[model samples]
Target: MTVVQIRPARSADADAIAALILPIQQQEFGIPITREAQPDLADVQGFYQQGSGNFWVAEAGGAVVGSIGLRDIGGRQAALRKMFVAPAWRGAHHGVAQGLLDTLLQWAAAQAVAEVYLGTTAQFLAAHRFYEKNGFAMVDRAALPPAFPVMAVDSRFYRLRLG
Candidate 1:
């Protein structure tokens, strides 16, 4: 298996990341509500200028097959967001997500962040297992701010301590 390279996202990567995420959003939410719901990226040029979160893309064979980002939540925590892997590449890309996550955690540690949090729906049971395998523990949705949109009413929140 070829090793996947992880790197900070460039302006050129915004569309690719948006394309990769479109289907997952539709599948999970049953609606095409990303560029509209989020709206910054459909314009492409402005999207790159806005710089969506602290973005990163995983490259293999010169193509981005997976992506993830950390959204600064203020204080000592950052929320993991927009994590996805192309369906065809999921098997070969297991560690790629973890690698991105490990890098994000290292960055959080450097910034003295005490915790990292993520939200996902109950439908993604596999994702829940993956988070647990990586040392995250499930927490109440109330633990997150009410402002954060819950993807599902029963969406689960997970947190991992940086220490």
Candidate 2:
């Protein structure tokens, strides 16, 4: 069995991260967003590796297979973003998604992040279930903290609190 290592993302992993996420977002999810639209992808270090926030990648066999990011939004809050796993690496057998989430949660707790917010489209039914199953509660948009970063494509929001 190939070992999957989850670690902090570096500038060198930028391309692999983009490669892993673009297809899942554009082709699989049919989201019409381009690379330019998401500038964060171009500078994961500058965007996510600051304050109490971070970005991580799941690497297996020397390739990036999954990724997740935490964006510190102040007030002990953070916005979870850019979570994606390769098609073959998904599900309980691989545990890529859950592993990424677990790492994020652990890091959040260490950072004293009181709340983690995420936004996704309703079309991602599996994602909604995954977040819900992981102690994230669905919340109305208006209920989100003002500092929360709401993406243009996001319609469904969820929040998870950590002590």
Candidate 3:
């Protein structure tokens, strides 16, 4: 089995991260999300690392196949953002998605992030199941923290409280 390394994202990883996400967002999900709308892809360190946030990438064979990030929302809360894994690297055998999320949750716990929330489009049925299986509970947008950055395409919401 090939190994996947989960590590903090570098500025140089911007293009790879975007490359990994764009196909899934545009082609797979048919979402209109563009790189222009996600400036964080262009400036991972600058944007995600500001204040109390961080971005991570899953690298395999020198290629970035997955990405996940966290934005501290203050009041011991955070917003999970930009989690995407290459289709070829998904599923339990590869563990690419799980690795990225595990890394993020581990780091969030150490940072004292008591709550983590995320928004997703209704089209992501499998993603909804994945989040639920991993302990995130579905919630209404009104239940989200005031600081949660709601995206234009986000119609479904979920939250996880870390211990």
Candidate 4:
């Protein structure tokens, strides 16, 4: 298994991060979002910088293989976004996703965020299980925070409370 390093994303890592996520968003999950449509992939640092949030990237052999983001929605709450892992580095073996999440959560705790929320599509069954396993609780759409920035393709939502 390849060793992975999870760290805060830099401005230069935008393209590699976008390349890593587009395939999964298109072929795997069949999301309609395109690279041109999702401008955030081109500016990771700018997109996730709201309130007290930040973005993270997982790299293996200097290549970005996974990512996760925390978007602060004010009122001590934040929204989790762009959590993805490449197929070659998935499962417990690579630990890419977990590392990214652990890093984000560690930062979130330090930032004093009370809750972290996310919106995902119904087709992501594995993602749902993964989120649940990591302490995110499923909630109805109406329960989502007003500032959560709901995406057009999002059909499910989850929230996790931090200490």
Number of backbone-clashing residue pairs for each candidate, in the order shown = 0, 0, 0, 0
138-161: candidate 2 lDDT, tens digit per residue: 999999999888899999999998
Model 1 regions lying over 4 Å from their true place? 27-32, 40-53, 92-94, 145-154
Name the better of 1 and 4 by TM-score: 4
Report per-prediction Cα RMSD to one decimal: 3.6, 0.6, 1.0, 1.1
Q: List model 3 lDDT by residue over 37-145, tens digit each.
A: 8877888887677656799999999999999999988898998999998888988899988888999899999888899999999999888999999999999999999
lDDT of 3: 0.91
Best-to-worst TM-score order: 2, 3, 4, 1
Overall lDDT per candidate, in order of appearance? 0.71, 0.95, 0.91, 0.90
Query: How many angstroms is residue 58 displaced in model 4 relative to the true structure, after the best TM-score fit?
Result: 0.5
Q: Residue 143, candidate 1: how far off, in angstroms?
A: 1.4
**Candidates' TM-scores?**
0.81, 0.98, 0.96, 0.96
For candidate 3, list the clashing residue pairs, or say none.
Answer: none
TM-score of 1: 0.81
Evaluated at residue 153, the lDDT of candidate 4 is 94
Best-performing candidate as measured by lDDT: 2
Q: Taking the tens digit of each residue's C-alpha lDDT, what string does model 1 give over 127-163?
A: 8888898899999987875434455334789988888
Worst 10 residues of 2 by lDDT: 29-38
Clashing pairs in 2: none
For model 4 the TM-score comes to 0.96
* Residue-by-residue lDDT tens digits, candidate 4, 46-129: 789666899999988989999999988899999999999999988977788888889989999999999999999999998999
